[model samples]
Target: MCGVGGIFFKSAEHGAKTGEIAYRILDGIYRRGPDSTGVALWHDNADGLLYVGVNCEAPGGGGRILEALDQLGTVKQATDGDGYIRAAIAYGGSEEDLVDAIDALDPAITVSSVGRHLEVLKHMGGVANLDAKFDLKSYDGRLAMGLTRYATESRIDFTNGQPLSARAVPGLAVMHNGHITNYHHLRSSYALKGYNFSTQNDSEVIPIMLIDEMSKGATFEDALNITVDKLDGCFTYIAVTDDCFAVVKDAYAAKPTVVAENDEFVALSSDPQSLREGVLSDIEVWEPGAGEVHVWQM
Candidate 1:
């Protein structure tokens, strides 16, 4: 099992202290997933922007990822570490541009949620290490979500970490709890459609499925409903977009998910304690029904 928590602010400049909020919330759930921690912060900008978490392994690996980014275009800032680098890239670039840039330096690297309003950053480490290395303690943004992983199906590396994104579709990111038993079959089907999967883990298949539906003109809600209907196992998933947030539970609802909201924000997590610390402390909390779709506006 993993811990996922997030808060959506009404404005990009709301002075919400997102980093501290995320830290407290995630720290509260540290015991649920002590293996690694990841966070994705989103804010509104005229240019459209996203910040992703990166893990670097080679001596100059972080620099190499930055160098490649320079060739692609202007990058705001980048943070590097033993095996990861988190950076911000300008939106509006073609999918090929980003894929080629990251591939040129490290084909093993993955860029998540390449959308106008979503940027993801995640890696393998504890909350304190991630905060210190990435300066998450001071990060301020409009919308942010964080995950601490326990590494169930996938290896404990950046590639198999939480907060997976849809590279071709900006402003779309996903965090999940529970397993997808039908992953292999779904992967095969998507492979035939020219969609490449980066990890063998079933969670990686989610973004591809949602992205495909969204591309066909389905709204985020529509896409999610259709996707959840097809899923064959116990699972609860939270997906975020620039303007919307949704939580989907399988027919069995075997996994846990708590949702609470107010006029200011909407929050969800695998447990109530994280939500208590992260977003609202006194709001009524409830478990979503099986085969339910909970949607809210940002």
Candidate 2:
């Protein structure tokens, strides 16, 4: 099993670093998944230009990705760890524009995440070790989602980690905690429509499925409704956008999930026990019924 969790600051008054908050929740459930941890944070730089983080095994190997960045616009800023690198892309084009350009650089270059406000970073380590590489504490934003992998569906590299971004739609990230039984059918269908699959993991399709529906002008909720009907699985997944946070549980409850909300924030984790760690202990906790959708709109 994998640990999927996220936290959204509902009130602008709360200026806490959302990535750190997401890390805390994800760390709480670290026992559930210790293979690798990934996080997505939403933040709009003062320039109004979009920032996207592209990651590969090492910063040295990312020279090709860097060259593609030059063609986009300007590389405003960049950073890296042992094997992961992030660049602030200032392209007037859609978020997918940056992603596609990076994908064109090399097959190994994974567009970790792209958004006007969100950046995705993940690596091959646990909650305790991963944070030492990148500074999640400074990742201030409105929404963040993350996952710790148990390596159920794919290899344990950083590229195969959770919080997979949807290539067709930027600013959309998905974290899944269980297997999808009908993933091959769905994957084949999306591939036919020009949606590329970059990972072997079944959960990556969740965000792709959502973004596909979203491209048709479907609301976030409507897209999820279609996802529930189209995919067959026992899973609890969470999705994040610049404007809203959504959590959906499969009818079979194949995976566990718990939610706690207050005026300031909405917190979700794999289980109630993890939700209590460094979170709002005073608030009430409950499980969304199977097939239930609990959404908090910003």
**Highest lDDT against the true fold, candidate:** 2
Clash number for each model: 13, 2
Runs of candidate 2 with Cα error greater than 4 angstroms are: 280-282
Native-vs-model 2 lDDT?
A: 0.77
Instruction: Encode model 1's per-residue lDDT on 87-191: one tens digit a residue.
Output: 666645686567645755656665544555576766566678777877776878766777778788888877777788754556677887778888889989989
The segments of candidate 1 whose C-alpha lies over 4 angstroms from its true place after superposition are: 11-13, 47-55, 90-92
* Model 1 local distance difference test score: 0.73
TM-score versus the correct structure, for each prediction: 0.91, 0.92
Q: What TM-score does model 1 achieve against the real structure?
A: 0.91
lDDT, residue 26, model 2: 78
CA-lDDT, candidates in order: 0.73, 0.77
CA RMSD for every model? 2.2, 2.0
